[model samples]
Target: MIVTRFAPSPNGPLHLGHAYAAVVAHDLAYERGGAFRLRIEDIDGARSRPEFVEEFFQDLEWLGLSWDGEAAFQSHRLARYAGAGERLKAMGLLYPCRCTRAEIAAAATEIGPDGPIYPGTCRHRAVAPEGAAWRLDVTAAMNRTGPLEWLDEGAGPQAATPQIFGDVVLLRKDLPASYHLAATLDDAADGITLVTRGMDLFRSSHVHRLLQALLDLPVPVWHHHGLLVEPDGRKLAKRRGSPSLADRRRAGEGGLAIADALRAQRFPAGISLSQALNGTP
Candidate 1:
């Protein structure tokens, strides 16, 4: 059975990019007679809002995307993430770090897809794990599982190189778990067979593949689809005030209609989907 998910962080309204992702996953599963699950990635404790959670359901429904069973919220799965983190710690694959963003940026020489890769400032330090940020020892992890690779439906085979990002935080200091740990653990827990999301997250998959191996979890094929971009080739983001689906709902647009438009490669005025799913000019 092919199982896919449309996991969104409910910190803001669902924009067109989100709708494209949801519809793509939903249609792929629906056509294959598989399961399409919805996951609320509300691990960002400070930014996650109750109103947004309610709005998430409303927007997804409005866009005619139905998820299988109950939606999984990351906030409610802290213990599960902790258990996985502890297991990694016992395996000597994780350690605690106290470096803040400012400290990392100052020391960083190589910038990653997300930001500065940690320079291993705390890897040698004997910092107690409790209440401290935990980072995955990528060097040790890669040593255990040598020469890893994963399949991408669109791009074919990919070599997993997690060391490019150095040590990735698994357990956050403020939040219970970081995105890498929580997402990888939950994907296995949910029995997902296929992972589909924007190509913007393509690099993150490298780290996720390593985590899956280290945790002895199930592996899933991935499809890093092209991102929906503005006509000028800029990525659509909530922070830039992209028009949300809520506003479109108020204007009496149907979810299925928008989904159909997206499927047909048609988009709202002033924005369009990129041709190169891997990279755009």
Candidate 2:
């Protein structure tokens, strides 16, 4: 059985880009007689709001999409993430890092998908400081797992080269798990067979594939679809103050009509699609 999921963070409103992502995931599952699930990625305790989660439900409902069973919440799975981190630590693949963002920016020589690749300032520390972030030793991990590959429905086979990220964070100082650890674990836990998300996360999949290997989690095929962007080529994002689905609903626009238009690639004026795989907006 094919299992797909649309995991959305409840830190902001659902915009057209999110709607498109949901439509793709939902249709890929239902059209193929598979199960489509929804997961609330509310791990950001400071930003995640119950009202936003409620709005997510309302927006997806308005989009005429439904998921199988009750939604999963990342906030409820902190222990699982912590355990995964501990396992990696026990295997000597994780190290506590006390470097701040400013320190990394100052020392970083190469940039990666997520921004400045960590400089490994604390990778050789004899003792970890209090409340330090945990980073994966990507080099050591690759040595253990050797070469790996993952399939993408849109792009076909891809050689997993997670080294580009350079020892990504598995656990943050403020959170039990980073996005990489939490999302990868959640996908495996939910039995997601196909991961359908925007192309901006295409490279993130490389890191995710590595995590899957390290954690002994099931690997899922990925489909990184094109992103919905503005006239200036900027992808619709909550931080950019993009229009939300709620605004459209309040304007009395038909939800099904909006979804149908999106399915047909009939984007609103000034909104276009970008298929760039560089993770740029």
Error of 1 at 156 (Å): 0.8
Please give, for residues 200-264, the per-residue lDDT of candidate 2 as tens digits.
89988999999999888999999889999988888898999999999998899999999999999
Q: Candidate 2: minimum summed lDDT over ten consecutive residues — where? A: 272-281
What local distance difference test score does each model get? 0.86, 0.91
Q: In terms of TM-score, which candidate is strongest?
A: 2
Model 1 Cα lDDT, one tens digit per residue, 1-281 = 99999999978888999999988899888899999998999878779877888888998898778899999888888889889988998998888888789999999999876689889988876657566788888998999999899988888898999887889988888888888888898899888888988887787889999988888889999977778898778778899889999999989988889888988889878887764543311
Best by lDDT: 2
Q: What's each prediction's TM-score?
A: 0.94, 0.97
**Residue 177 shift from truth in candidate 2, angstroms:** 0.7
lDDT of 2 at 105: 91
Q: What is the lDDT of residue 211 in candidate 1?
A: 89
